[model samples]
Target: MNFETPSVSLNTSPENESHDEQFVNNDTLEFKYKVLSYYNEGKSINQCAKYFNIDRRIISRWKKVESQIFQTKIKRKRCAVKSIIDRSHFPILETQLYSWINEKRHQGICLSIILIKLQAINMFNTIYKNTPESSLEFKASNGWFGNFCYRKNLVLRRITTSGRDLPKNSVEIIKQFFSENCQYTKHEFFKDWQHG
Candidate 1:
């Protein structure tokens, strides 16, 4: 209650803000949780707002749904908005993207959020390339990404290695490398091995 709103917050939370004008609450989900924790620690909403460089009104809104915010952070790493988004926005584009994701997942390739969003924008451009409206663009905002995950039943999890063991075909790969690259007599190790 003792906090006053500044004219404009020029600097936001470092390393967590995206200067996206449309989706202003571009702070990471973890950051949001931290802000709420700060507020819950007997700090005023206005104080948390000023300290975090976010709007006081936004801080208040987050306070109302503090529990949900924490749950969201647990479920995922980032969230653009806490409210529900459009159920179905881009049908064809989403269908293609979902399929692309499944295809890559099957290939044992884990795609990051940035990579997925970038691919989404690329797909959007390609899908709507012939559209008459030049304003049809997709920035692949985090909100959209969240909703996309929800609709597609995709879960984002931290990348962890299954084990530290090398591949079972390691010996074959090494033999292939030596056979393909260095058949010449210029290398001492190769000369010794050949003689041996």
Candidate 2:
């Protein structure tokens, strides 16, 4: 079963599409066999991928499966696992916001607003930690907090699941939280408001 069939030669005019389909259908198994043969012949995966028009990873996988099936005992490549910092660090914050929104459900608090508030606080904490001590002490307006809130709000509005018109009561709760935390009115700050 041959795998590396020579590239089909065409002379000028539109090539036959049906012929291409037929070749693929008829030659897939043979092609797989040939690909394995090429691997055994010491051709690098890059060379095979270039010749085969398939991803090199797929070729590597094929080699593994073939080796396993044939009892070749060739060890498969180790799949590397990467560690990332899980952002589930703010369960307390999430719970607080959830409670606030639940309490304000009548004032029209929606998941959209909840997500915005959480992201805003998260970004604020990040900026607050990173800002210079001189600027912090001088109280110079770097606009970091405003930008953080604006960007966080935009991202929340853009990337979140579709928002619902929050409960009429939740609106009041949202307004109250903003008032208590930053003395900013929802209407004065967020333009995406309607009289519900």
Candidate 3:
């Protein structure tokens, strides 16, 4: 049996009447320029996002990154540097945090404990406030910390079937649920379980 292969011709211009879609409209280019200009004028990405009804992140990428690469400089300030993760502090913070994690592990405390302890020590809110990816809001005795961890990919999430809170021994229950349903070990619970 013989099979015919599909060929793509790069030599022929799509605009040269050689392709099915041969028209490049000027309006599209004009609209793009307008969007870029709005972005260049120090408008918040959210503002441009609302104007276009697109995701703020998309507008941010276009304004701070994509636009800089593609468009001419237009009397605009450079994109403001957002508060960033300080790696120098990570070694110190991670050591302290993991030490606390170990202590909590011995007590059969959950990962939620680390978050709570951090907040109690006044470290979570102060030191990590400037960290871009750390949104450590303390809702003690609530599972918001777990959801935050799941969102940040610090741990995989087992889909919660209901709005109801998991029972006591939630970690073990969650671990068991994942073991039966998914093939991966829940590493987020590993240190606690190991110490316990």
Best by TM-score: 1
lDDT of 3 by residue, 1-196 (tens): 7686647566554554433232233124343455567877987677766565456765554555454345544444333322233333234444455565567667975554455545534645555677863654543233544543333334433444658776889999877877775643578457556887
In the order shown, the candidates' Cα RMSDs to the true structure are 15.7, 19.2, 22.9
Task: Write candidate 1's Cα lDDT for 34-82 as tens digits.
Answer: 7888888999988876667778998877777777776663566667664
Measured by C-alpha RMSD in angstroms, how accurate is candidate 2? 19.2
By TM-score, the candidates rank as 1, 2, 3
Please, what is the whole-model Cα lDDT of each candidate in the order they appear?
0.78, 0.51, 0.51
Each model's backbone clash number: 0, 16, 0
Name model 2 segments beyond 4 Å from true: 1-27, 68-196
- The better candidate by lDDT, 1 or 2, is 1
- Residue-level lDDT of model 2, residues 39-149, one tens digit each, is 779889998775565678867767666744344332443322221222333334444444554565558644454454555465445544654531333221235334433
Model 3 residue pairs with clashes: none
**Prediction 2 global C-alpha lDDT:** 0.51
Model 2: lDDT of residue 20: 43
